[model samples]
Target: MIVPNREKQAKLRAFLAKEAHALGFAQLRVCRARDAQDREELLRHFINKGYHASMDWMEETLERRAHPSNLWADVQSIIMLGFNYGPDEDPRQLLARKDKANISVYARHRDYHDLIKGRLKQLSAKLLSRLRETHPEGAIKVFVDTAPVMEKPLAELAGLGWQGKHTNLVSREFGSWLFLGAIFTNLDLLPDEADKDRCGSCVACQEACPTGAFPQPYQIDANRCISYLTIENKGPIPHQLRSAMGNRIYGCDDCLAVCPWNKFAQQASEARLKARDDLKAPALADFLAMDDATFRQHFSGSPIKRIGRNRFLRNVLIAAGNSGLDSLSCDVMPHLDDSDPLVRGAAIWALGQISPDQDFAHLANQKQDQETDPDVKAEWHLALKGKTS
Candidate 1:
């Protein structure tokens, strides 16, 4: 005779490991939520410093974000899983061309959330099917970057990887290229061995940050982060960091792209998330021509659509400013009268860069009558004075 709890745990672990592999997970690990006080303290400190910027959602679900049991109540074991989205091409190559905008590797393909969530849901269904017979009363909930769970720390806890100094979960085998997902379950599965911290004396990610977004190791200032400023932020991008944004029109993966550990990441097994040729390094002139409908059509399944036409154009304007190509002066001119304030402001800033004195003056004169957005007006005033911000 064997202990029932041990047998149950063993059975559940074996079943989960098989199901995860078949469902396309790169790896799966389980752990009890024993300790998270330090992470909780860090979260509070992150809030105190306003490091999250305008992302009030992080503040809104503070309690549930810090604690696992608070989320599902009956979660006895936390299943932290890795979804590998290995880069199909050299990610850093896009940065070489001055006239081409560098879209992040992750956004070069179809959105990972949609693809990974669909797979996670399928895995959940399989788990429930197994539970109906063995652990009929067991409950499970899945989360993928949504919800309040401290996913990076939880992944670290469940032996998926150690949380790198960049605050992203990094595994020795998978590197930093893995997308994390979680399955909160009532079944008490045997916990996996925790991953050890391997980022010793390494500061590659820190030095890679263009805007100095990392104030110290293991922390990121959301306000200066190109990813947060481009994707998450809804208002005007700060003047200082705009120029540092370079040609990265979507998200910045400089820190991740520079990681030495990514050398070991396997190319994505999911073909749908593979990089599209057209998206790799698109011409800025052609990139500027996309209106909302065209933008939606081009980036339908891609993550670039999250920023919409105006914000995307705002990023393009900064890229245009950095381009040093007089040819794009005409391209940036029409945006002086853009419907969105952020776009108009970015246009003003870009025009002051490449525009010959005559064309810029004419643009300022032409848009003077129609412009009412205060921010745009301020930018227009600044541009006429031959100032570039």
Candidate 2:
């Protein structure tokens, strides 16, 4: 019969913490992946209210989400790590530019998923090296937001930080601007004491959301979230929320930007997390003209690359429609013949905004000959009738 090596496991934990700090992680903590009844209620409330919007995967695999053991029976410990990616400049500064594009700070850099995953895997490999030398039976697994794991709750249990009223983890040190990731193992390492909730009575994060995504304290309905509508939802945005969306083309940073705790936040050290000057308040007209190849090239080191050209242009057109930038109408005209119905629909809306024919008859007449996609055709007809397209 084999028994775990206690001395080596202790050394492994300390070494991991040291290596993790050197890797640019602001802080790290550990916890036993226990039952997360509190998180289950929050997720259930979000799902019931239809806040998750089209992110249906959040509803699937419910059992594993509520109970970490359901994901891996042998898992006994979870390592919660936080990486600071705070921008040197304030994000709210973008809000003042209601006429310009507002790309979230996180997307200003290379895709964080790629960056975090490679780093986490390296850390996991470090542990595996120690396991091979001593506890040969040890095993490791890594996860980020992509998994069904209840990372926030486990992170709370690990003393990384307490969950704030807005549902984002907040630390006294790095505040709410940190990205979270986790690793679970079969080792029974000592768990850190959970952080005391420091939110007090502040409701700034909730009040700051432009779309009213948070229904109550500590809960978000993803359906009403600008981030979800812009990044996750595939179809045309609902009319009621479009004007309120302003120029946010990718994701909204209002809630995260308003948190007072972030005053203590430090600028990110990862050169990959730095803000790209071109993406900072990028011209809506420039983003509107991006073809697939151009989109890939422009966002090569940026997270916006994942959304593809059509989805991105659709967002830009919506902002252009609300922009009241009538001069932009000429720039939007060519997209009426775009291959994607989504683009054509958005183009029609932008045309209706700037084309002063009372109705979009001028643009509709031009599109009638070549346009396909019944959705876009009907939209063109409505635009011609002086109706909201």
Candidate 3:
């Protein structure tokens, strides 16, 4: 059981920071892996209140995710990394362009898990090599959101930032635009001072939520979250929430974009994380026309690709319906007959919104007789009655 001296540990920490910055990470800090008791209880409270929505995995991984030692018994330190993915402009600006799709700023480029995981592995390897010189038995493991790690809480404990009222980590330097990654190690390391909550008297994020996802300060109901509805949710968007979704075809950024701390946010230094020109406010008509092949090809390396064509088209149809562009009614009509019942249901609702009432009644009359799926039929029933919710 060899332990590195204080001077040696301090030198290693300095080396880790320098290398992390060189790799384009915005912030790096560490904390004892055991410093996670409070977060574990908070996670339990969130799950007990059903705030996790349909993401059952959160409950399934409760024990393993509660603390770092529960994940790896030998782990003694946790290193948290933050990368800035701040948008060049306010993402809320695109919401008014009803004819164009409003994609969340984070999903406009390459998938971040891939980008961050690759960098984490690189940093892990470099650190491992250095560790071998002092303690050959020392080992490290890296995670980038694919695992059950409580990254935000661990990051907060590591002095990266405090979790804002929106339940996302908020940084004084980068605001709500930081992408977090973690590295667990067997060697004990000096820990940084924890970042205290800086959200004093600010409910800007809460007020900005279009869905009113927050029931109280520092709490969220994922069932009403636009981000969860558009991304994690596998079924049709709730009828009542659809009208409020507006032109957001992918994940929503309203809460994050409105954070006051973002005034100090910097443009993403990593080119791959920056928004692509074509994805920045793409025409709703164009996305509504994408088939499986086109959607796959267009979003080849993007995070949006993971949601699949049918779901993507479903979101686009909701936007088209909300757009009030009668020109898009023709585009929405095709999706009404889509193979996926989810798409068909959303399309029915969209057409009912953009199409003439008489025309929609005529189409509903013709299609209701042929529709077999109970949910799709329900959509037709609701839409024909001129119901937006």
For TM-score, the strongest prediction is 3
lDDT of the candidates, in the order given? 0.83, 0.81, 0.90
List the candidate 3 regions with Cα displacement exceeding 4 Å.
1-3, 387-389
Model 1, position 211, has a per-residue lDDT of 94
Q: What TM value does model 1 have?
A: 0.94
Best by lDDT: 3
**Candidate 1, which segments miss by more than 4 Å at Cα?**
1-8, 35-38, 365-370, 386-389
Query: What TM-score does candidate 3 reach?
Result: 0.97
The residue pairs that clash in candidate 2, if any, are 51-221, 51-222, 51-223, 165-218
- TM-scores of the candidates are 0.94, 0.92, 0.97
Candidates' RMSD to native: 2.4, 2.7, 1.5
User: How many clashes in candidate 1?
Assistant: 0
lDDT of 2 at 248: 87
- Tens-digit lDDT track of model 1 for 249-365: 888888887778888878888787778889877899998888889999998988888778888888888899877788898898788767788988998888787878777778787
lDDT of 3 at 99: 99
